[model samples]
Target: MARPKDDDPDMFRIIVATDIHLGYMEKDPARGNDSLVSFEEILEIASKNNADFVLLGGDLFHENKPSRRTLHGCMALLRKYCMGDKPIQYEFLSDQSVNFDHCQFPTLNYDDPNLNISMPVLSIHGNHDDPTGQGNLCSLDILHTAGLVNYFGKTSNLEKIQLSPLLFQKGTTKVCLYGLGSVRDERLHRMFVHKNVTMLRPKENQEDWFNMFVVHQNRSKHSATNYIPEQFLDDFLDLIIWGHEHECRIDPEWNGIQNFYVSQPGSSVATSLSEGETVKKHIGLLQIKGKDFMMKKIPLETVRPFYMEDIVLGETSLNPDDHNVLKKVEAFCTEKVETLLDKAAMEHTGNRKQPTKALIRLRIDYTGFEPFSIHRFGQKFVDRVANPKDLVLFHRRKAGVKKEESGADNELLAKIRPQSLDSARVEDMVRDYFGQVEETSKLQLLTEKGMGDAVKEYVDKEEREAISELVKYQLQKTQDHLKVRNASEDRIDKEVTHYREERKKRKEEDEEVAEALKRAHSMRSQSEDHPCDDDRMSLDSDEESRTTRGRGRGRGSRSRGAKETTRGRGSRGGRGSRGGRGQMKEPVIATNGNRSILDAFASSSSSASQRSARGGNKRKTYSGMDMSDDDDVVTIDDEDPFDISSSSRKQKSQRKTTSRRGVAFDSDSDDDIIPLPKRRR
Candidate 1:
């Protein structure tokens, strides 16, 4: 294949990487700065290559709530390398309001007149740095707010995802970059299967553009519904930049069924000491000219080399019954460690600077022998390896046991089949437990998936109030539903009582489930065929087939190359909107409830003519943005708990000046007093 010419004016050059995992083990002594150093190198690479922009797939930060030090390091790097006065060659043609709807400043950093940005950095959030909490903010949101990075692909409405690509044009070559930040795999899978995902195409000349999709989902199938199948993606896409999986498969692999090439740049830093991390890490320098593209894999030299190997002692001549068995095993392990150290030394022979230390993991299978002290063994190489504490792992194979004999073993076997090593998701475990129970006995108000999501949030993000908040939210929703149904006071009370009882019962059952899972984890099999699996869901072929066919049919039925425009924008709105720059629409603000904050502010200033024009009941438009119904308008008294004003005494006094859901005229000033909605009971 002929490569794109270096000085081609039409070519769009982009530096692509993913899963930088900044702040991963930042507290560690040996590998604390590994992620940051590699990330800096990526930026330097982009600068030296004179790339148009840097596109990160996801997982830019290892933690959803990264430490201040991590945030400072990331911000400093971006400021140092990305901010400049270099002229951007590409023309951004996408609607900024729709692409960066989550942000207050919808425009890209480079486009903003207040900031002087040269090398633009565009990124989505991965599972590690996905949004959480009441505000639904992520680490990238901070970077975006600071005008250091252009954050896109955030969908507040998970029920229906409308992917509006960021369209860019350089000379005659047009590129459409579509991004979807990390979504819960199962929910996203179901959405795709049900054909709820929509990819909004340009109004005209769509075939002339090279389309690229950047998604941070499970590319590798973990379970039936835990992964997004490549076939589910639109066939129009030219390239797919996959993230989340840490293996560095930077070479673009052709997906014949989907007719798109997938390039997984993988994690810049090794987050784990697994065998997959041993692959040479690289970031791709992608050049797109018209519809043709070429990917050049650029090696990352700052990454700490990780070497992993497994040895089966039983398969060797070593016998457990031998009197010198312990000494012999120790000698064998020492020899393996020395060999890995030599290999690590050999890896740094090139002009690249040597890393702090190499990471090594040796898995020993002492099937019929007693395990030795791993801590003592690791002390010998304390200065040699980054992870000395977990240098060696001892495994003992499980014997053929009957299901009836061991409850723990039976549960483990039932949950994890021999053919697959992927662990069941928290949601799956919750569903299985509920499925086994009688339908009448199962909790009615709280759903298994909802509880599962809450549990996962609590466990993974350390959000202490996740479970309590879910319980409260569910109860409130139930009460609202019953009230809407016009249930009697007695009936409502009875329903509430039943719900509480069921919740209590469910809590007790959850404890029992937790204990069983703990036991299963302890007695997990370590056989080569069924090694311990990570916290990922399993895959299903049935769901994949359903997703492929349903999505394919759905796409075929939609208008080809038709633009999806928001109301009041223009006749030819959305990405193709040629409306004057001065006519920029106000961003549609989303509140906690299905209410519009702007509607509340707009209601205070509505004139008699405006009211008459709205027919007193129709939805209103504010600054070319459609507002929600009056009933869904957020008012002062109904202040969001996450809002700073919720705890302010001055704000409370201001709200008390107006009546509930009533407008009052101020005698002192010309302004009309806006009534506040009553607080929820």
Candidate 2:
């Protein structure tokens, strides 16, 4: 690389900054104005330096979709300085025309003096402002359309990433500015290895141009995790602007290249309270000549002062109730706050005279006290100090505290003996020591001095066994109740069956009545249709035979309506005289328990036939029903046959009780209640 000739144009001075994080303060209302304030301060500094243009590395906004208030404030601030004043003009150095494939266009005419954009802001979207959805639009697109900023480093096609350079001639310096937006680590690695992906560079003899590469990538010297190695960019780029790191850094003549420089402006405001965030932040100003560049570190005044203090309590088993220890911690916190206030007062000047509100992070190293309870000491300090907006208190066990060797630990360590100590042997010893220490700690927790004693001291072995037996007894009782309930359900099923049988019997009786009526109707129809004397004679003969049989059975008083025919005959030889015989009787139907009416009738008919064969005039009984020669003498016992309650009681009494464990309690004795041991308060 050669220096620019003295006859060439003036030097190019561009203000370079990154990670404004515009919407970062939306969460904490008290500190919600911090990010925007810091950003405004940066813009003011850029304006005061007479910068040609502003280059934002990445993450101008903290969120993909900033809040309405945040966007408004940002637009107003940018437009106030960059709009309607001295529109910048750049002479084209390369043959390539300006490409707006995935970018936006200005709303107003660029050449119009009324629509001049003076100090134009150029930036690329970081991870936070990257397209979140399929739409492929971001918050930066809005500002671009409004003619407030120029957003490069985007591709119209998402499947491929291509770096597009903004080629311009500022004075005699041919500048080729190429930008690559933030990509996820995995995807970034893929892009780097891709055959089609390549950086935008000057063609052929145009290599004399200043080739500056802007990227938002994690670059670290020691760890390769998610970082792009600097060696990879050695040949392609002259100057590299790095972002996404919070600490400010400048490496002039990077990689031992005399003219190559890698500069990082870092975050203008702290987004998180990490160790790196407490460092002094700065914005960078790059003055580029032909192959060489000069970077100046400008400290940011708008960043809130942050102080992190770590106090070692020195001893383990700290008591939270110790007034002396509490006083010591309180004094330490007070001294740290006073020191910060004094520093702020010395630095305070001009229009920034408001009392500095500091973020004091206190880390305490103490053991045996719960982390939550240690906040009491921090709270005392907070109450004593004024203008303390936020106080973060953290407690941890001292990192290298020496542990007292117990007898058990000593015995365990004594068993391990080796000739000499190598790395492997030392590692083994360390592992064994830690293991023994952990086991000892666990064993201590089990003794009477530990919390387990609170429960073990009161309940002895006998009481525990008694409790176990009681649980088993109650479980057995529950099972018995379930069995009794099942039995009751079975009984209900039986009753339902009995009722269903009765319903069937009533239905059969109805059918019989219907059949009798239907037969009578047919008989009347036949008599009316057949007037022939021969048909009538035949029907009369049948009727006469049926009547004679009924009379022989001594059923003279029975209605001529023709009762249901009985299957069995009586034992009497002939019809008795009217004076001696009782009124004619019609056999009544009787049902046995659970037996169908037809089955009962069949049984009764068979029994009567056997009695008639003996030829004796005797009364018969069937299923609690009395049948005699007298038709008026009918006896039926109405009492139910099944005693349901008595059976239930018998089943319950027969259920075996579970055998008692431990002491037996006789409920039948005078004392039914067993006394229990009083609980210790």
Candidate 3:
């Protein structure tokens, strides 16, 4: 109905709801949650709030075979709210009216233009309701032909009559309602066809025209579209309401203008079979105060709240203990139910999980039901609970945690919240989850070589040779590198440790020297103060007298003897200094030096162990000398080991000359051939 009124120039009113998965749980007769409570509630709120028009974003039904009860529920709800001037006959016959239910295949040839509450009801198809999946293909034809709703599920705009401008007055603001009744399906190749572009085109582009686009695609890339480039929602759009997922959320980030709004009204009911489903039931209420539209969220939990609390029923057998346990549980529930009824009202019904301040969305999960009458409990539980009309009983047949082939329960089973077991949509979620995981796994396998069973067999003969050659080259290189690295590291470590030890020793020696210097300074100062001053000592004690002038026969003579002794000490120190130069080259400098030389020879003799071991094994002469096999020992002997040194050569020549003169190193049966000393020990 895209006809704008010239009288009121500035504003238009619209209400948008998305992703109402109607007829979702009809087969779940045990739960008896066949009614689309969310959608029904939205319709009531929209009607009560006096919205100009309402939009169903998508997924009008979960399948093609929507039950007659579902159809009647939808039509009845729509008939009340979707019209401004509908016939009075369409209303309930009496205040104490019977709940109307539709017959199977209810005929609807009664579409008319002159009705008061008969505004166009636009709808879209969501992923769960689209073909190519477990969705209905003919949900639209059935819905449209029933005179229940107007929708767009075609590739080329099949219902231009509803989108036409003839449905509004000359002065009344017109809203060109367009709906992509069915969302996209990935299984179909898009040959690049355009997506559903709904425009609230004003009559001849009036500046007051507002577009309320209704759609059923994901805000992100979902399974609905297989195309690489997503259908960009960048046309002459004001606000595009979306559906598919069951969580009430709004994206204020769209279009950078803050004028675009989208909502997945969460489902039309509290009950969902989806995994990880959190029921945040929401609806958008738009206020048309001028053209500046204000949108506020109406969570269904506000008026008709949902309540789910844990009820632990002990052993439910007929035993006395079991009976007592059940009584205790019943007592607890009775107390809670009373408290809940205290806050509940006729319009505001409290369910298992109390939704005290959102929209009217009811959910009560009666888990741990024993062989007791939950029906009796439901009937007598609370007051003004829409008694029999709003109250619904559910019998949960929980399949115990799935076990593994080894009879061990799955690890994830513990992680799963028990509330998830109440939903049947978990299967769809699991399938999708596994599908994504499988695709990712496949990609990883294709890229990594070790993921396949026949990876070894898949290798070509030439590839094997190439790999082997690469490994051999790598091994050789690694060996060479390791040898050099090991030798360097070992040598550096030894040097570092040795330097640290030397530093420690030097520090200790310096400390000793400092102490000795301090002692010497003290002694020198005392001696200076008392030099030949026997009188100075006499002032403190009765001692010998002093002889200051030229040393007569007194304490002075003894002092002169002391000076002579000091002079003698100086002479001895000079002599000692002179002897140090000659001592280094002498073999008999001291027994300590001689002992050190003998020890070096002994160590050299013992170190011949390494030589024997090396000589035994096949010599692996690597390029670098760093070998993990430490058979090669470094022995510094008194005799020269480095024959290339100049001193060593000279010593060897002298030795050869001595040998010629029969100056042999004669040892009494301990004769061993040794290399010449590079430097004197």
The TM-scores, one per candidate, come to: 0.66, 0.53, 0.38
Indicate which candidate wins on TM-score. Answer: 1
lDDT of 2 by residue, 237-316 (tens): 78889887776674344656434667877787777655566677788777777666677778887677666666665553
Query: Is candidate 1 or 2 superior in lDDT?
Result: 1
Q: Which ranges of candidate 2 are over 4 A from the true structure?
A: 1-9, 87-89, 92-98, 106-114, 156-159, 221-225, 250-253, 257-259, 315-323, 349-355, 367-390, 395-681
In candidate 3, which residue ranges exceed 4 Å CA deviation? Answer: 1-10, 27-38, 80-117, 128-137, 156-176, 185-208, 220-231, 250-253, 257-259, 271-279, 288-291, 301-681
Best by lDDT: 1
lDDT of 3 at 151: 46
Between candidates 1 and 3, the TM-score winner:
1
User: For residues 166-259, what per-residue lDDT tens digits would candidate 3 score against the true structure?
Assistant: 1222133433334454433321223223333333344464555545555554444434443322235434556556665555665323555443
Give me the runs in candidate 1 sitting further than 4 Å from their true place: 349-353, 401-449, 472-681
Candidate 1 yields a Cα-based lDDT of 0.73
**What is the lDDT for 550 in model 1?**
16
